[model samples]
Target: MIDNEMSIEELEQDFWGEPSFSSYVVTTCHKARQKPIKDLSYEEIRCLIGQKIGLRFVLSVAIDILQANPLIDVIYYEGDLLLAVLRLDLDDWKYNQDELKTFISILQENRSKIENFEEVSNELVNKYLQIRL
Candidate 1:
């Protein structure tokens, strides 16, 4: 059985081997995919979620992390994680209602903090709201 408690690398994932993508973000997702959930940093989580690699496993963790820090950042700046989530496929969120709502709440609660740093974030956040989810 795949162990939630172990990293993909530790479990010796058989479906696919390690990926050596040319892009930094792509590489981050592969490296982060091998690390334990608890061991993953906010930036790594953001990278994985942004790539939509394993939402079934990673989405809830992202929610919990966002609850602690709605403005969860990456190398670029704050709210980058939030933006990554916003960019997630609408279908990816269809069955994830509770998690999606919690994320919306995080946006509502931290709107000012996000807008203060990323000027375009407000527009993106507004667009996210219009989605049927």
Candidate 2:
């Protein structure tokens, strides 16, 4: 089982070590990519996972963060992380079914945390569930 505490360095990386994108957010993701998962702030994780940069490595950490605080946000309002996560490609979950299952469980588990948050769209979450379930 890939627990939340695992090192992202353990995962295979698909990109070069340096920042390829010149944007500010991509720069932030490049920095976050170097840091240990435990060291990342919610925003950094959000950017990396939101952009699908090093997603396989960052996902478990991001989901663990979501499990802890489902409404975790960055520049956007609460639940921004979930919104980003919900936008991920389902193909990313192919070999990581266990992790995907855990992520879905986290969504199910955290429903109460998000269901009523004004900034989060419950309809989106439900739509994701309809596809994922």
Candidate 3:
């Protein structure tokens, strides 16, 4: 479990030790966001996990930004990794143009945070795998 108190340095050490993890996470998120999940190969599950981890981190940061700025309201967050990646069979949350713009801007501004989150998530997953082995 990652707490908000965790610093970027900790996350970077955990997640960014290797370059592949960061690349994979970013690529996965971009691809998943554009395509339907049903079309993705089964082998891409790890990528989906990366997307989820990154998105969750982005959302957390976005929420914090909203709290501080109060510029826009975030009505819904797509929590389902499969649905979010595939963009299938999900509820449509309406957002005003300004709200949507602000949300995108916030996410873009905090791109580094998402990457750091991915690093942390990957580190934890790796640890879990080591334990299982």
Candidate 4:
């Protein structure tokens, strides 16, 4: 669990090991104007799972972004795999027939990064599988 004393920046640095997407603005829904959950360390957020104290920062960011564009039909994430279904229809031409294209774009752009992430997740999954077996 994240120590309640630490600031959001501190948690982001601890977990992601990089500068958070936004360091200055508070992103959470809290009335006190606290930073969003993205700043929380993975372990910290995981600890608060039952309480639902905050949104999953990474998931929220991605979903919000996708929702804004209006191209995605649906986005289902199974662990690290972001399975997206594009809504392609002639009536809604502006946002149609591009789901596959957008998916490909996301895959191409983030392939290397996601590949590494999946490798780690796969190892963990395999470990669990072996235990079950």
Most accurate candidate by TM-score: 1
Estimated TM-score for each candidate: 0.76, 0.73, 0.24, 0.23
Cα lDDT for residue 112, model 1? 74
Report residue 5 deviation for candidate 2 (angstroms): 10
Query: Model 2: which ten-residue window has the lowest total lDDT?
Result: 1-10
Give the higher-TM-score candidate: 2 or 3: 2
lDDT of 2 by residue, 1-133 (tens): 4434443544444344777679988688767766666777888888887777667667777777777777776667878888888877788666556667777787787788778777767776776566653
Q: Per-residue lDDT of 15-113 in model 1, one digit per residue for the tens?
A: 345665678887787777777766887788777787776665677888887889776566677767777887886678765777888877877787777
Q: After superposing candidate 4 on the true structure, give the runs of residues whose Cα lies further than 4 Å from its correct spot.
A: 1-81, 84-96, 119-133
RMSD, every candidate, angstroms: 3.3, 3.3, 18.0, 16.3
lDDT for model 3: 0.35
Give, for candidate 4, the lowest lDDT window spanning 10 residues: 83-92
Each model's total of backbone clashes: 0, 0, 2, 3
Give per-residue CA lDDT, model 4, range 49-109, as digits (tens).
2223332233333333443432222212332123212111223223222433444455445
lDDT against the true structure, per candidate, is 0.72, 0.72, 0.35, 0.34
Shift of residue 35 alpha carbon in model 2, Å: 2.5
Q: Clashes in model 4: which pairs? A: 27-36, 28-36, 88-97
